[model samples]
Target chain A: MSAPIIGLVDYGAGNAASVRRLISKLGYRSRLVNKHEDFEFVTVLFVPGVGAFPSAMEALTKMNLVKPILDFANSGKPVVGVCLGMQLLADSSEEMGLTKGLGLIPGEVKALSSMEWHIGWNTLDCVGECSIASKSDGQNFYYNHSYEFQAPKEYIVGVVEAENPIVSIVRKHNIFGMQFHPEISQISGFKLMRRLLEEFTDA
Target chain B: MLKKRLTGAVTIRNGMVVQSFGYNRYLPIGKPKVVIENLDRWGIDEIFIQVIDRSAKSLEPDIELIDEIATSGILTPIMYAGGIQNEAQAAQVIRAGAERVCIDTLLHINPDEVEKIAKRLGGQAIVGSLPVGIDNNGIIYWYNYQTKEKRLLNDRLLSLVKDGLISEILLIDWQNEGFDEAFDFRILELFEKYNLPLILFGGLTSEKTLKKAFDAPMVVAAAIGNRLNYSEHAVQTLKNQLTSAPIRTAYYHDRSIFKHYD
Candidate 1:
């Protein structure tokens, strides 16, 4: 079977280049989805983000991508959000004052109470049988964030301890959110990405 | 648990990889891309790249070099330092694919700019690079290489931490950098007051010294530059020896997909 085309959503938040490079390294083709029409034939959608939460939401709204993203998530396609992208999947965020998120996942993004930011390599404790989390069980993935996803226990697939047990990966049916940057998490990260991509393609 | 990081630093001077000693003497190594690629293949937790000469020559962060490294398709997270003086440069470096930007001279020159950078790029993306020197009496001072100035390390840094200007601190031993001496434990003792996540560097040439630095509860990562230039798979070897520590072991294998790219 041929590799699936991964649509990497670019909403002006940084981190697209690194994710694109990593996808290409996996022997798959990924295109930047800047407009709604770009997602027409894409098998899986990847929302890769870095930077502030408010600005990311503003970019998505300004680009007329908010509705398209929601429609795609509702359409039962595999949607993966990374880092700030993952935070944007929540109902709301406390960063820069209660910014509304995409609300696809049942959660809220809150700032970590730790004095030190969660900025390093951290391992994920798998809590479910989600393909990505199961493969990445007890494996270290690179993380650089100040806010974390606070969701119901059933929606959480993986977690990491940083001051408290914070949600690191959440899976709700076809929609998946990873708090860490799998693109830069070295071999294990690539394996997780490949597994997620394979799940979508095989589905 | 948050794994303690083993970062491989690649110091570049005038676009060529160099081994820096005391931040003054430099020995030329090979190309930086080659070194970075090897580090990525060895499964390093993170990569720190610093262009040592950019600030001395009053040049900007080498955008071309950054673009080259970013497009090289290395998968390890990269933290870039040197010549990042403003918020625009910090944004540019992140856009070029660096995960974090380290600021040294700016911490002493204009700390407000550092705060502005943290606000712009988020605190996690900003790192305070404090190159410190110790006197015989065990007093710690910020060592400025360009001005040869020494300012007493004090509450000013704590203010930065309080204001969320920097998420992590890259503590460098100015007096013992690039040398085979042991890391000054007194500096670690002094920094423990702040309780910030520390990335300790300088004079850490062996596992013994690295373990000593890692033993400190505040230290979250340890970086090595000059010594890594001499050998291949240096990071992997070091990670193997320090397995009991919080450092992540290399998970790359023959069946890994990255081997296909290699």
Candidate 2:
């Protein structure tokens, strides 16, 4: 199968260069989606974020790329959100204050009830049978976040298995949101990403 | 459970990797890319790139070097230290590809700005770097290189840690850094009541010393400088020697993918 063009969202929040470089290293081509017009030739959307929530949403709003991105997700193309980007996929967040998000995924972002910070590496517990479940169960991924996605059980693909079982992976149709960083997750992350690329190609 | 982290703390001097001693002497190692590449290949938990010359020499964060490494497809998270004073500089460092920014001089110069930086770019992105020394009398003091003040930790630092302005505190032993087995775990005793997540760096090379540090519940990571660069697969070999059940031991070797990409 020909490689799908990864539309790396570059709104000055996440390090788009690193994600783009990772895509290239995966033998896939990527183009920065700073403006709405850049989404025309894109096959998949990779939303990467690491900063606060309100500022990230503000950058997306300022760039005027929110509606186009929603339109792309509504088109049934594969979309991946890493770390804070996954939180942005929710309906609202309470990072700095109550702020609205992209709303592609049916959920809300909340702070971890277990700990104030969840840094370093942790294994993901597969929930129901899904594309990521079969490939990434019991596998470790690097996670650096304070908040987690609070979604329903049906949409939850994987979780951290903490006292509260914080959501780590969420999926609904073609849109997927991962709270862990797959780009810098080394080999384990590569396996999940390869499966994601394959799923996108088959779609 | 979250696994403990082992970070490859590299001391870079003028775009080249160097071995730092006592924060005054520097022995050149090699290029930054080569050092980071090997560490990433060895599956180091995190990479702490401390450009010692940036803050002292009045230079900006090394964006070009960071861009080079990020473009090379490094999988480890990088904590960049050097000349990060304001929110703009911290944002620039993160945008350039570092997972977190370490502020040394700023924490001593103006600590109020650290809160702003943490607010702008989440507290997770900010790492409060503290270079401390314990005197013979057991007095814990911070080494303020800018004004040559060995001030007490109570001077706004302890407050910041208690308030959780930064995600983690990189407790660096500037006096004993690069000297193997010289790190004093006694300083950790002082912070026992605070319940702060600390990354212990400096003079932590030998297996015995590392094991002693991992015993501490608050020490999140062991940042080994100078010594890891001496041997091949140092991180893996070191972790292998210090293997305990709770410690993080797995690291992936994706040489084939990198080789194929090239």
Candidate 3:
């Protein structure tokens, strides 16, 4: 099998460049998923998310990327969303008075109940078997956001406890979401990205 | 559980990295990229860069610097602080690959704009930085280098914390920044009431100060600049010494990660 073609979806914001740089370090080349045509040759999709949810949704809408992303995920090709990117895959978010999301993985992004803003690094507790479960369980990943992805039980790949168990990773078929940033999570971030992307390639 | 952070800071002036002493005296370090690369390799949990002279010169944020670091393939979470006076500039900085943007001037001059920036980028992406010091009479006041103003924590600055406009307060001890055992603990007393996580910086290089500061429940991270730049794997070396601290174990600097830079 050939290597997976990675494409970073650029929705005006998000850390697409940083994620692309990480992909480079892992010996994989990626492109900016700007137009619909840009998604053609790519086999893997990465939504490098940051900032507020409303503006993020608006950027995706203005770029007309919501449908393309949905179609890509529906096609059974691996699509990964990090931080705000992960929240975007949900049905909606309560970030700025209830904004609608792409609804790909079925969930809502709500304000964290335990704390106003969960910053710093936190360890992820693996929830059943998923990508990197054997290796990534109890590994610390960088987190910087106020909202948490409230997905269904089956989709949860890992979680971090606060006053609540915040969903850190979610996987439903070929779609995956990480509430924490793997691109900048240091050695663990590198290993998590490499191990999972390698698995995606092997699959 | 969220582990406390050991941030590696880059102090830049004239578009070059430098070691700063009490916000005035400077020792030339090197290029900004080289310093950032070292911090990333050394496993610093978070990296924040400050171009000290930008706001003083009425300049904008160093986007070129941010872009350069972003594209350099840094694996550590990065933040940019300096000359970011408004919402658009903060957003621009984030767009340039900084996960968060630290604001010092804006938090003092126009707090309403901070609320707007928070509305746009959300609170987690904004860090309010106040360079503070205690006077000879044991009075802690926020200091402004541009106007040489030292006032008690004013209503505007307090409102930023009260309104939750910033995620954390980067309380910098400007007077004792590079000096050992000089950062006055009274400086923290002014902010302890706000119930916000604090990232202590300036002259907080010693293990005694870091440990004491970290012992406080609200103190989340201590950003060290001069001390961490002294040697190779300084980040690891420093963290290893604070063995009892809640900081993550430092990752060895592996060169093979960058070898296949595609």
Best by DockQ: 2
Question: Candidate 1 vs candidate 2: which has greater DockQ?
Answer: 2
lDDT of 2 by residue, B1-262 (tens): 7878888998888778988888788899998899999999998888999888788888888888888888777888889998887889888888888988888898888889998898887888888898998888898888987677898876477677666678889998888898879997888887687788999998988888888888998988889878778789888888888887356685547588667865
Listed in order, the DockQ scores are: 0.70, 0.73, 0.70
Encode model 1's per-residue lDDT on A1-203: one tens digit a residue: 66678898987566888898888887778888989798886888988888889888988999999999899888999899999999989999999899999999988888887634787788899988886678778888889888888999999999987667878999899999999998788777888988888788777
- List, in the given order, the native-contact fraction of each candidate: 0.74, 0.68, 0.80
Residue-level lDDT for B30 in candidate 3: 91
Clashing pairs in 1: none
In model 3, how many backbone clashes occur?
Answer: 1
Output the worst ten-in-a-row residue range by lDDT, candidate 2 chain A: A13-22
Instruction: Flag regions of model 3 displaced more than 4 Å.
Output: A1-3, B260-262
Docking class of 1: medium
Candidate 2 per-residue lDDT, tens place, A1-203, comes to 55578898888875677677777777788888998789988898988898788899998999897898899999888888888888989999987789999999899888899988898888888887887556799888888888988988899998886777779899888888888888778888877887887678568
Steric overlap count per candidate = 0, 0, 1
Per-prediction TM-score to the true structure, in the order listed: 0.95, 0.96, 0.95
Residue by residue across A1-203, what tens digits does model 3's lDDT show? Answer: 66668899987665777888888778886888888988888888999878889999998999999889989888888888989999999999998789999888999999898887899899989986985654889889999998899988989989997879899998888888899999888778888999878877666
i-RMSD of all predictions = 1.5, 1.3, 1.7
Give the Cα lDDT of each candidate: 0.85, 0.84, 0.85
Chain A superposition TM-score, candidate 1? 0.96
